[model samples]
Target: MPATIPFKRSEMKRLAEFAKREGVRAEIEVNGFVFRVAPDFNPVRVAVTEESDLDHALAEFDRKHGYS
Candidate 1:
């Protein structure tokens, strides 16, 4: 919930956890969506008032060309 910065390995891990607690979770990327791996854990469908998220951007070079 602050300024942006470079994506660090540690930050990614923590971000993933924070998302889990907030009831928004994902397994990995498939298309532009994060697919879920777990079966039991699920969140309710609702909107948020706060504004903060892990801005995960796709690799420019990879997107332009083909497979990464």
Candidate 2:
């Protein structure tokens, strides 16, 4: 099941600014219609811990996905 959140139009600006700064997507529903605000283009970053097994797994994934 999905959660139903109550939204107010007064918070649009704050939400937009937050989304832009954090590079996230925000959705708003009004009158049964949905509107989305997406941040500017930003590349995704992957973080790996300093572990041999995790490093090997990430390398294997990159090789399998042609990202190496």
Candidate 3:
């Protein structure tokens, strides 16, 4: 299973704004770990596209993208 990283929407928005204004990716160090925030990343959405079978969709995507 893939690991998940959590970020607050407000924090992400602030980072996004900073990156956009500075024209660079925002970097932060927490503990011994470093993370670069994507300027174009957005987690908030008004609606989601429904999927009938997510497994099949992911399998197809992997097959097409050459992912194991």
Q: Please name the candidate that would achieve the greatest TM-score relative to the true structure.
A: 2
Q: What is the TM-score (0 to 1) of candidate 3?
A: 0.36
Instruction: Tell me the lDDT of model 3 at 55.
Output: 66
Sort the predicted structures by lDDT, highest score first: 2, 3, 1
TM-score (C-alpha) between model 1 and the true structure: 0.28
Candidate 1: how many backbone clashes?
A: 0
What is each predicted model's overall lDDT from 0 to 1?
A: 0.52, 0.77, 0.70
* lDDT for each residue of candidate 3 in 1-68, tens digit (9 for 90 to 100): 95444556686678878888887888766655565765564666533444436667999999999999
Worst 10 residues of 2 by lDDT: 42-51
Comparing 2 and 3 by lDDT, which wins? 2
1-68 in candidate 2: lDDT tens per residue? 97554566567777888889998999888668676788888576565554666889899999999995
Could you tell which candidate, 1 or 3, scores higher by lDDT? Answer: 3
User: What would the TM-scores of all predictions be?
Assistant: 0.28, 0.40, 0.36
Over all chains combined, what TM-score does candidate 2 have? 0.40
- Select the stronger candidate by TM-score from 2 and 3: 2
How would the candidate models be sorted by TM-score, starting from the highest?
A: 2, 3, 1
Q: lDDT: which is higher, 1 or 2? A: 2
Tens digit of lDDT per residue, candidate 1, span 1-68? 95443445575677577666776654555345443422347567544432222122345555677856
Model 1 CA deviation exceeding 4 Å by range:
1-6, 25-68
